[model samples]
Target: PRLREELKKNYWIVDNGYNSFPTQIPGEGGEMLCDDEIGDNIIGVLFAAQDTTATVMTWVVKYLHDEPKLLECVKV
Candidate 1:
């Protein structure tokens, strides 16, 4: 119930096909969503993207740091 309420407060489901733009811009063609939905989508995506990027970056950095030879080989 709580989750549903929160979803209702944060998301406004738009009708399908309401967001066709002249150019093919992913997600930008979506219908005009309510402020809450927009905010939720922004926050949710940012968090998810940031978390994944950070995790991958951390692993990559660690790998490079621990394997300088490998890094050098790649740089060549």
Candidate 2:
């Protein structure tokens, strides 16, 4: 919620009242995200999660490095 204005574009609203990225449901005939919109949002979310994922992985490696037995078990 506190992301700087410059970084705000990194996140996207799937659909709001404006429906800037409008799409439609195939059979139901309702507004929804199309393939491109889905892909765009997914990419945004994944990129945003990168730092968090890397931090967790770094912690995991640090823990395993401190515990040889645990690391060996994980390798198997």
Candidate 3:
């Protein structure tokens, strides 16, 4: 607890507890902001965004390749 005490002595860290999101670490008084549990939540959000974007891009490219006439029209 010496490190914690030392850090707190120099810096004033407070847990606001406004956000209920899950954090990487449990409890407060560490390096995390407000001791929020954000490990799983952030990972899920990032994965979802990445997967959806890839799916859309893949479909768009496949559609464009299949319909060369449609692609040419868009260029003009």
Candidate 4:
């Protein structure tokens, strides 16, 4: 896939956990991740992020329902 190729061509820079350190980190098995693994990880991260955002928003709305002044301030 194009994403895999781009990650490979860019030295697997996206999720290898070495962006600032400038080193190559291995996957769970001490090897570079295959294309499928990268895609799966991407999906996992997306789902996790969305779930977190939804939880935060739910809590915010719940609290807002209890505080009319804060909710009105937020609308402005």
Per-candidate clashes come to 0, 0, 5, 0
Off by over 4 Å in 2: 1-48
Model 1 pairs whose backbones collide: none
As for lDDT, the candidate ahead, 1 or 4, is 4
Per-residue lDDT of candidate 3, residues 1-76 (tens digit)? 7656644543432234222222223235555434124424344455788754454455446666899986796589
- Give lDDT per model, in order: 0.48, 0.49, 0.48, 0.55
Off by over 4 Å in 1: 1-48
TM-score ranking, high to low = 4, 2, 1, 3
Q: What are the per-residue Cα lDDT tens digits for candidate 2 across 1-76?
A: 2333322333343223231332232212333457566546545645677754464455457768999998898799
In candidate 4, how many Å is residue 26 off?
35
TM-score of each: 0.33, 0.36, 0.32, 0.36
Model 3 lowest lDDT segment of ten: 17-26
lDDT of 4 by residue, 1-76 (tens): 5545544655654345342211233565556777467546545545777754454455457767999997898799
Best by TM-score: 4
By TM-score, the better pick of 1 and 2 is 2
